[model samples]
Target: MFPRLKVCCISSVEEMRLAVRLGADAVGLVGAMPSGPGVIPDERIADIARAVPPPVMSVLLTSAQSADTIARQADAAGVSAVQIVDRVGPAVYARLRTDLPGRSLWQVVHVTGPEAIAEAERVARHVDAVLLDSGDPTLDTKALGGTGRVHDWRVSRTIRELLDIPVVLAGGLTPGNVADAVRAVGPFGLDVCSGLRTGGALDADKLAAFASAAGVQRLA
Candidate 1:
């Protein structure tokens, strides 16, 4: 399957429009987080989620630690999917599957080392997809997302080979290296944030370059 494109940290309707126009399969809306960038209010997330048209996923990104809390936040935001940014227990995911039926729950697996592959395997059973990221939630400041550093693609490829579910790759992806990343990791999707931005704002040229490099053509 062709690798899909997801533009994260979409803060406004304008950013959503830009992302959809650039052929993004999904757009991430950041909710409250303990650290890192793109932390916005749930109310704002709801407004953007409502405005997003069909065929484009409005993903609510959260740092909530429990299944119930994440489910409630996703429900209240009215988003199509919930991207879990924290390292929650397996029971939490089990609960999410029951509580948020029909809604996609994406678990973020920070590739701190080879152990991440095992973590991905464990979490894959509960969530629809596993996103391999470069953030270390263990840090005292907690760098969940928006960290412009790439994880080991070789490890990601091993994880992808092991899991039956789709694996999405994130962290430090840019127009210059997305094609290489696709070849190396072979992930089902690519999620970008800081790579497609300039001066803390989404850059149209960068977005277009990234989409094109990722083989996502603009919809007519």
Candidate 2:
């Protein structure tokens, strides 16, 4: 199992490349936004997945879709892994697990209330890893993952303790306090959306600063 606490950024190809150039360990390809900051067209995700060079794994984001459909979509898009969020429970995750044909599925759990951690822990075996998101980004919410607000670190920490797989902590993470998150929760990795943006899109300078705070090593 991978033990490094790497940092990942989510956006289009331009932003993804910027994050990579700066110091992001990985980049996420927004799948079906419908609502959220990381929404990109399916074609865009496919293009981005192809554009990113090897070793820097590209991830796909999806909402509460069926496992078979999601797996197929991720495979079709050629992403290394699929990130699933939207208040799915253990049964749904378990059911989705069967849909993963050769693709890896990363379950993104929204830690809004006190029970989210427990729910995520219960569904830990259903996926490769779990991503802690927030409830603020509902389908109606215009800004998906870029609410610019942080959730309770203890929630992520608790979930991490319950699951053996890697945990990717997201939601309102920035260069300013990512280190605090790292120190507090000790997650397997970090995922950022709006924190690395200049305008509405991804920002090169912010990306660099976030990568630094995330502890991503500079490439030679």
Q: Which parts of model 2 are misplaced by more than 4 Å? A: 1-11, 89-99, 136-144
How many clashing residue pairs, candidate 1?
Answer: 0
Model 2 C-alpha lDDT versus the unseen true structure? 0.70
**Whole-model Cα lDDT per candidate?**
0.89, 0.70
Error of 2 at 99 (Å): 4.7
lDDT of 2 by residue, 96-182 (tens): 556655556687777776688777876677778888876544445533454567888887888888788888888888879999998
- In model 1, which runs have C-alpha deviations exceeding 4 angstroms? 1-3
Query: What residue pairs clash in candidate 2, if any at all?
Result: 36-144, 37-144
- For model 1, residues 154-198, the per-residue Cα lDDT tens digits are 999999999998899998999999999999998899999999988
User: Which residue pairs overlap in candidate 1's backbone?
Assistant: none
TM-score of each: 0.96, 0.86
